[model samples]
Target: MNEPFAGAAEKPIPEIWYGIPHGYVQVDLDPPVEQIEELVQQVLALPDGLRAQAEPVVQFYAGFVTALNKQNARACLLGMHLDEYDEPATSVITFSTVPAHGTSAKAIIAGTAADTVDGSAHPLELPAGLAYFSEEERRTPAPGRPAEGSDGPLMGDIWQGTVAVTGSGGSEIVVIQLVTSAVEMAEDFRNILLGVAHTLSFSDPSLSGDEAGTGAREPEPDSVVAAVRSVFG
Candidate 1:
């Protein structure tokens, strides 16, 4: 006998992050947008009362990463709502794969360390088990910028960590960042994020129906300045 709704079922996957234990809140690195969209449409087709139940689903889709520099490159984003997350730092991490041109991970790491050292940056190493490069710097906000009704500028810290990994036929650079006005919390935030990065992993190259690889088509670049203005203006 043929099962009618078998195709619409969702499979459950274990929620383990390397060796770190995650409870209740499950994180999905990159979710299948197509299936989410299909479910959204199905919910929309439902009559009134039942539609409200789909609101959370709609919100979840809103947080989906619609595009990035690499069309098929994998990205991990942690969406924090200002009202709910209440953290002083705004962090962003991006991973992109491109032609290696015979570049080795060791060379990339060395180059990163040298470049930062020239810029007066304090070099930092990846955790005991991870292999990546990182650096930190203090950033003082413009003196005239309005902040907390204060006449003086606000000081903060900015950290960036980068690592290169070999992929199918190219190399991938994983960049982790942390920007915060919370000077007292800066170091803690950096360590926390770096710890999360230590567990980073990737999947094997995959081919779609017509595409050669996942993220094969690049997305149009979006300007951060323009995006901020569009949202706040």
Candidate 2:
């Protein structure tokens, strides 16, 4: 379930924009140390059961966000859905851009889906404007081999859904990637992710940002929220 995006501080016009559900919180990529420590303190104050569940989710994203920061990710969101999921599952959503080279959008989508080695990808039932949609589930070993005495999965399976759309006059592709470890919820997440992707659009400077301008395509906050929930709820 989701609510109208209450609103966030004004920022530069984004190349791509999409909506996520209520269970998710956007990770402030450039927050002061105090903000992060405050979050940690809140988690610590939770009851043992809730704290135990939240701690790992926080840590997992801490590491993941660190990696994304180094890659200069555009945006990041974290989802913790203990009630809706079988376990205390976590989801990481990120936005990033990649060069389109000279490839056509359709070809990019097909190639991306075809490259799903461990899982599968395809076009959405409702197309999201020459978008690339994909789902993958795979296990990648941790950076280093496990100790000799170690057992079980050294790393773990990774499940993710991605949506990519061309922007900046086709010079680049903006990607929306959502990753979670709850493999069992893959289908549900795929549905929810598609719902979000369906609402995505690239900001067009040429279009009217003014109320009097014709062909103004700015999204209404409420409509985006409604679209994302149409599939999941």
lDDT of 2 at 117: 76
How far residue 70's Cα lies from its native spot in candidate 1, in Å, is 3.0
The TM-score leader among the candidates is 2
For candidate 2, the lDDT comes to 0.66
Which 10 consecutive positions of candidate 1 have the poorest summed lDDT? Answer: 1-10
TM per candidate comes to 0.43, 0.66
Local distance difference test, per candidate?
0.41, 0.66
Q: Write the per-residue lDDT of candidate 1 for residues 1-233, one digit (tens) a residue.
A: 01100010121211111112111122344557797778788988987888887766666545544554224333444323232357534444444444445786446655665676456333344322224445555575532346787766665555554444333222433444434444455455555455444443332112223444555432223322222222223
Q: Write the per-residue lDDT of candidate 2 for residues 1-233, one digit (tens) a residue.
A: 55433222233334555665768877776677898899899999999999999998788768877888777577777788763535687887777767667876556766776786755566543333666577778996643457788885478788888887665465566677888888888886776677666656554322334632577445444444455556445
Each model's total of backbone clashes: 3, 0
Candidate 2: where is the Cα deviation over 4 Å? 1-14, 32-63, 83-86, 102-107, 110-119, 124-128, 141-148, 151-153, 204-226, 229-233
The C-alpha RMSD in Å for every predicted model, in order, reads 15.0, 6.0
